[model samples]
Target: MIIADNETAIDYLYYETVAKTVVKLIRQKSKEPLTIGLHGDWGAGKSSTLLMIESAFKGQTDTLCVRFNGWLFEGYDDAKSVLIETIVAALLKERSGIAKVADKAWDVLKAVNWMKAARTAGSLAFTMATGIPGPDLIQGIGSIASKVISDPKAYLTGDVFNKVMDGAAEHFKEAAPSETTPQRMHAFREDFEELLERAKVDRLIVLIDDLDRCLPQTAIATLEAIRLFLFVPNAAFVIAADEGMIEYAVRNHFPDLPAATGPTSYARNYLEKLIQVPFRMPSLGASETLVYLTLLLYLASGVSDSSVEFKSLLEVARKALQRPWLGTGFDRDKIKARLGSIPSDLDAALQLAAEITPILTEGAHGNPRQIKRFVNTMALRVEIASERGFQDDIKQSVLAKLMLAERFAPELFNAIARDASADGSKTISILERKVTSKGGKDADDDPMADWPNIEWVKRWAAITPPLNGIDLRPYVFVSRDRRTSAGIGVAGGPVEAMIERLATSTLGITQVTKAEAAALTPEDANRVFQGLVTKIDQTEDLGKRPPAAEGLARLCGDRPELREPLVAFLGRLPVSKIGGWVVSGWGVAVEGPQAQEFAELVGEWATQTSNKPLSVVASLQLNPKSKRK
Candidate 1:
């Protein structure tokens, strides 16, 4: 089932508590305008919280809510203008009798446009004064002025335009202006508040979402416009973004900011002045993550968050989540009882989520999006496995365990895949016993020192009881995540299954023998060869070396076209990797002149390379000519 990634439900993230607090804060009556900063990392449910906040205003006549996404207009329009126009448009749409008020707001918004153009021209003049060629800056300012002048009446009649002309006339003068900057700012503020009063909107709450996703210029434009034109009594702005991103935008917006040269106190002070109230979203802990995972799994399993059963569970869990002292009512049994016999895959997912909650939460940095991505990835891997006829063979818990390794302990996971592919059936048996073995403290003292991969395997094996004796190469083969699929390792599609079959059974290599390799079409052979190269390139430890070597050897012996690439790739490997003996033994598999050619190739590699990889093999050669390197 495809999970919805966007915010649709109010309490899916159990954010109602925080949402209520925001609602309370926004709903309070105050004389001064307020800017509430909702700060959280991306996908930490900032948008969802915003949605809940919007919901809180439903059925209220006195408040008008306007939801705006700054990212949508990043390049299409000026963010400053879009935000101003949007609020005015929303207010006009709400009260049909307020068109005149919207017209006045529109005029003030037009004045904002004039103010921006004047500033741009001033900046261009400054750049020229500093001996910097600002032809492009000049051209951009001209282009903007042209667009504004295209609507001549709006641009010409604006007092802001008159103000700009007045300022330009006194460009180099020391005399004071008829109006100061603060007076102009106050004029726009008064105009906006009058529009709200005219519309009978007691409070205008503008919810700005995805400010973090916008470009630096756009983000700053939105924030600065709200501060300049919309900061008035009975008007509030809620900005949802990661504080770091906004701070980054701030740095980019004002590159010469005082904090840029020293400590960041100036930037913090700037942010504090703009965002009067800061509300940071709390990161999910272990128990909270578990509840979140269970809810997402329920949603992914075709159960809607609006369903009565899910809502009941969410209400109880949300209360418990709000107050830890209340104790959670969302244990596994409670979830199972509420969900009532879910699909086996979802059931397995639920169990897997609980088992790996701690590590997964920590590894994912307690981000809910990462957890959802993990679940989505696991489901995709299971679907891939099922497509390859291993539907009944792989279990969800087993898949989750392997994915945990792939996601969190990547080096250790790669080691397991490399070794397990070579040893096949015996690999799992050995690891199972290795973990269960009651070795004394000495065996455990440095389990991680000599071979950390082994220690990782032991710890992993001990997590769940059902992974014993299962040949895991197929799961590893099918669980090729695209993000980590680059470099040396398993890749997706038909070749992955082919490689799994070849590497799993070392007994006579019957699964993909010489005959089978010969029968493969050229396209299929190339794909398989490339896939093998990736695995061979990633094989690090010796215990994990044979599978890649054996698979490469078997394919090279059968496909004549693969020989040169194989030799070239092997030549690049260190002496410790594709050793002289391994190459010579593979030569035996090839037979005839190819064997002698392979030996000569090894001799050539040893001659040019200083490591002398073939020294031991050269010493055992009966022909004295072989030791020439």
Candidate 2:
């Protein structure tokens, strides 16, 4: 699917067109050194993008591009040291073309044994190394290396070049400052101009990319250096950037930029002086993106079944594209009108299919881990159904499987089980004692403490049309200590209530089955209670229960008899299974039926609800345990 074209080298993809635009712009402006800054997120193709650009212009234009790591030069102590090294290296590579012209120039400077005040040794080497007329670079390089070895250091650092230039300033009848580094600079600049002039015999362009990858301060300074100080008129600068990222960096470094300097607008105005008109990348339209994703899904999956189709697949893309970037919004009606026509039988399956698209596609939402998980999950079920030959039922099974997995996430069942532990028993009892006086408004302690556990609890809550679980928080009883000579009663009773809470919560954690109490693995049962205790402190909404369930389940481990008693105790009344758990038609607590009496109550609380039976189901699940069904 990746067809890289312009600066589109294999390692560096895309931006072929942009790179061409950049090259053409700089070539017409000047035939000297050009600086280009490529911008994007750290790995958003900035460095590699320019490398491809560099590759394209290599032979035709006397061009050079380097991906300098800002961090690499951090040890140099200051920006100047790094800048000098980098630019010198760049110039040397540029001037030291096929022939080695800088050879003689370097030999003259080195023989003088000069201390570098301005001219860089590397730049001098390039000028002296590249312009020779010989076919081989090394032949000329060796010729120069032989002459300059004795005083190589002086070629860049010394007083010789400046002394000669200054000595000639008046003789040439020039009036520029003769304090002489600039005169020496004029010497090198003239040398470079001549070298490039001869090498290309036409034009040259230098493109520098990935300045955006630099740390905030470094990027600003690097950009400032080239733009303001080293503004080579002949070398056109082609810089790419996200305007916001650069401005934010400036604001971070100088608070005054934001506070006093009209920081919000300053950087934008600053960039105006430098940035040549940008070649903007166009955004993909929703309908176009939809078609792109559809084709990608069909290609990746190989087969699209009735269980997964294009329309619903788009919605799945919605969930996968949850990140703010990429603009993954769904115009439901428009999408339906467009894709809604794709073979009616495939609608449900295609939507299911689309759900897996973002999982497969690479973009903001396309984290490989998320992609693998979605495929593993949905593909497993799809394969199973295909083998069984239940072609028609595949869509339902896939949805059921997804919903089943949802039940297990920290968000739902797991979270409820962890929070509904005994550690908060004393706290709840204390709240009760304090709240009884006004009967004052109940102080909301940790919301986690009283949240209902059990799959039934969740099922009831999600029920549409005023089911038994509709906001049934009030009737939920917090078992308190019975009054005694010790004032509010025996603290021992609270622990017993905690036990009852565990037994009830356990029914959800591990489904109760018939078994004998004696044969039950006592330790397994005990750890279930213990595990709940351990998890309460660390529990968040996506709560994790300790390794207590399996151990507790083993209490009856292969012993059916022992589990039977507890199972019967749990089975006092049947709780209708809503989705995963069985619940009685009562409001949010115990399992029971109260259709006639609760009718008015359901109607008064929620008049529009058509399904009254389910309303009472929620109410009962939240109620304390009624007799076993």
Candidate 3:
């Protein structure tokens, strides 16, 4: 059920080299207490690493596997009594030499168990199931008598008083040793050694699993107890943990106490060294990720092993990922159709898929959990596509429509911004208005035409759309200027333009590329723009203005019906012999100008410029209730 484990006769997917190294780390330890540490980013495979290594050392004569599951025990082992219980319990579970004297150990364990109950009960009365005490001063005595009535292990052969007193003294001493501080000492080892001596053994191997999942100090104390107390003459311990998480947890939990006391860092390191055969784990390779991903897709789609359908999905994934918007092995269509069918409430599923793919493929920058979320969202979109028959009938609830549009526009705008800023290039100007989904009106700014660089503006206008279109139908491309020798301002201030005059340029572009178009690279796109520059500069004359600069006299080359409102038209400049808008007006008289007509037209123009933008406007007539100065 928990796939966190690697190889345990389950559906164990193989990862490379991690398991073997961990085994080697465990197998090669010296007399010092060994603590093998396995670590990984959460869900990146630490648990699996632990289980694989655990399985590897299962029955080896020198190997003892103890899985210290965090959930089973609740208290911090530093509590004098808790540590004793943990060590004794862990040692018993193992096939240690101490196990041979199981009867004696069991008797000792039962006595220690009573320590908790007797401490809870009042001095004279030992609490029982009936909450009754004996007539005289019987603590554990009367209780033991009642419970051990027939069993010899519980029965007393000698003076039950003397035997009980000796056993009581030994039990307290073993639980809280006198030699070292109660919390820091290793008397549990002394007890274990005594038991092992009775059983006749030398070395013991124990596994501590899921220790990393506990509070760091508790986990550390358990390890410390295992290291110093519950051991034979030669003892080995292999602990399972997320090594980094464990270190962080331990450091955060204990702070200076563990480090300043002795070599806490060194002790931690020492423990780590014991895990000599620790199976190190790395992320699955791309091929392996794909294999698992395919398997996962097949399962999520509920399409059982029908080779025909599986193959069809694979084909869809392959083809869909080739689009510029969707990276390879990442088809948005496949994601929506075959993953989680995205719960319908998440209307931004398509856009989320587009954004997530980069993260998913980013070098184990993502894990299986993230992978699942992505698949789920994609699957949702697929369900929509299926229900709608890939047509328009799939009712996009208002929230969903708004979600799709808002999510799409800003991301697209950001993508454009990033593209413009990429490779240390500053984007001085962007001609399009970034249209997010809140309004019908779009951007009122387009400064590319007025920039001083005429030829650069020429090529930009030629290649880019005339104006920002809301249909999302335009093909975006990046064209690099490939010309090694072109004029300075040909393609917007050429490299080394101050002293240079000409630049050789090249341009190539194919518009109408689908959403799934081949990638548009900066170099290639720049080159295409450069070609357009070459064409425009080759034909246009910068030497002498064409009689009346055509662009100045009219709206522009394509749409010449409207006039440029930015230009000021004046009747006369008395000082100069010019028949154009004048900077100074002396003796500049037009006798038939209409005042009321001019006032209304001027008011309309002013109002419209502020409220509704026109691409081009001719002349202003008048603002009513106004007169010529």
Candidate 4:
């Protein structure tokens, strides 16, 4: 039931409208060369939109469309050469029936090949004259030269050396000695334009995608190649990339350019000059996200996009998206009316979509790819629980609620996990109250006063099917893998050595070891602390105090600065998974100003309804006088 992350021709996000507009613009300006920039953030569906534009040009005999992904040619010596070659190849294939067109295409290809050879021959000359191989020499030879260039001695050997010299000589003999670079470039463009005229191509629309995924060098090179055909009649280029990345590439390619030589930045000017028409992909709004999610969930349920049922749903969703501010897109009645009847699975999917949309919208920032990923992850988790035989226990709404926290507010999620675990009850009592009731109350009067003052929390709390008394251990258990730990891993030397001693069993860590752990530099101590926290997080059972706990206690006892962080670490541990050993082990670690904080924590543990043993121990710790004689 996984939704694929690849770019598709599906008009799920209404990008087809944008594509159609772009195609119309190209047609209106088909007589002149046109360069259009399709700008969007990664995963914002730039690639998919490009596909829509290409699809729009299908069956237009007068117009030819060719697709090229710059990322595929990332490591090539010259991205410009490959791009030119690609366009020529596409032209040749398209006009294969015209014999004269083939000859003209071959001539253009020959010019590209000569340009490649010139680069190689120049590199060979530089290496022989300077007794040092240039970077261009290695790049010019391609994969075979790259492999042996590291060992210059091996590069000078028999067949490989002969091959390089022979290729350079052949290209040099065929090259036009009197032609300067600018003149050659002009001639190549003239030849290409003549070829287009001969082939009767009204407009050669080359769709360039994934330029943002390429290296700065490759990205800039591809843009440079497009500039060669910038003025050639009947040539139109539609480039899809993140504008920011391309700007960064421009800055990188020309490091000496001033930050701003005019009203616009240098990089901005470069892109503005090259890309005449720019279309920025819009981020999905809340209503659009809801409609998108519903359609995706339907697809996940085995509803094929090609089916009449799916098409009908898509039409409704598109209409709703057109005016999202009116209401949440596609209510149940509307769906049922359109489809005649809603399957139970689809009804459940709709319910789930509604349940998660509010938080998912804000969390995923309305990116289609991100929303799709979240859906895929949620569906996979449900399948996993079903396979593990606890499917019935894991409700979709509950899991969705927890996942919202997991994805957006990880610290909050960890806090909830600790609260749920404190008494082995698996329920979060802090969220039991209605969100609206918290308003107008004094800070001290509100139970949620201790929670972060973020708006998303309120929205999440107001979501239907409150988590109040629901046992969430099964859901939490299924989601353990998604948990993030604060540990930075072991820093080598004394810090690493200290972790080893502290990680040992109680009997293994002697008083001398505790003294050594306490004397560590604050930086080293924090590192050791983080390492221990990571170890405890990975430990399968919190039923007993982990061996690292004592070392953490001793380290914090000496370093008061770590007390707040230590309390935070303790607060994140699942209480239900822990045992009575946690109630009294801190000793002097919680002394001084932090003692009240620790005491308050213990008092909360004592009042929790879950984990009787832990509650009893915590209760006794707070009131030793009440202990049995």
Alpha carbon lDDT of each predicted model? 0.64, 0.37, 0.37, 0.73
Candidate 3 residue-wise lDDT, 1-629, digit = tens: 01121223222234324656655644554344455555444456555555666677666644445454553574622332354555456556664445457765665454544343233232332222122444433322444334343343434345443334434534433432222222212333555566655544344455566665666556655554454542345456555565644544444443332232221242245445435445444554443345445545444555444455444554454454333233355444455576544333222333333332332343233355435443444455545456546424232222122222122222222223334334211222243222222222334444333323444232332222233322211111111122222212233333222101212111111121222112334443333333323322222333322222322222112221211111112110011222212211111111122222222223323333322321012122222234232
Q: Which has the better lDDT: candidate 1, or candidate 3? A: 1
Which candidate's lDDT is highest? 4
Candidate 2 per-residue lDDT, tens place, 314-418, comes to 444444344325545443443555565455434443464344333123222222223324334444444555665754543432333223323222223222222
How many clashes in each candidate?
Answer: 0, 83, 55, 6
Please report how far candidate 1 places residue 82 from its true position, in Å. Answer: 1.5
Error of 4 at 540 (Å): 34
TM-score of each: 0.65, 0.38, 0.40, 0.70
Tell me the tens digit of each residue's lDDT in model 4 across 1-629. Answer: 78889899988988888899999999999899899999887799888998999899999899899999989877745787789988888888888899999878866876775555445434332211122334654333444333333453454456434434433333334445544455556778998999999899999999999998898888987887888898899899999998767866765565555545433556667888899999999898878888898888888777778998888888788878777788655888888789898877678778888888877876666689988888888888888898999999988778888887777654456556655555332224434443556744433344445333344566676787887777776776677655533112212366655665666555545643556755777787888788778666644457867777887787787778888677656754666777888777787888876665566556656766667888889879878889965
Best by TM-score: 4
Stronger candidate by lDDT (1 vs 4): 4
Which candidate order results from sorting by lDDT in descending order? 4, 1, 3, 2
lDDT of 3 at 370: 39
Q: What clash count does candidate 1 reach?
A: 0
Which tens-of-lDDT digit does each residue in 82-169 have in candidate 1?
Answer: 7887887788778876567766666565555545545544343212112232454433344435534455346545654554543332
Model 4 TM-score (2 dp): 0.70
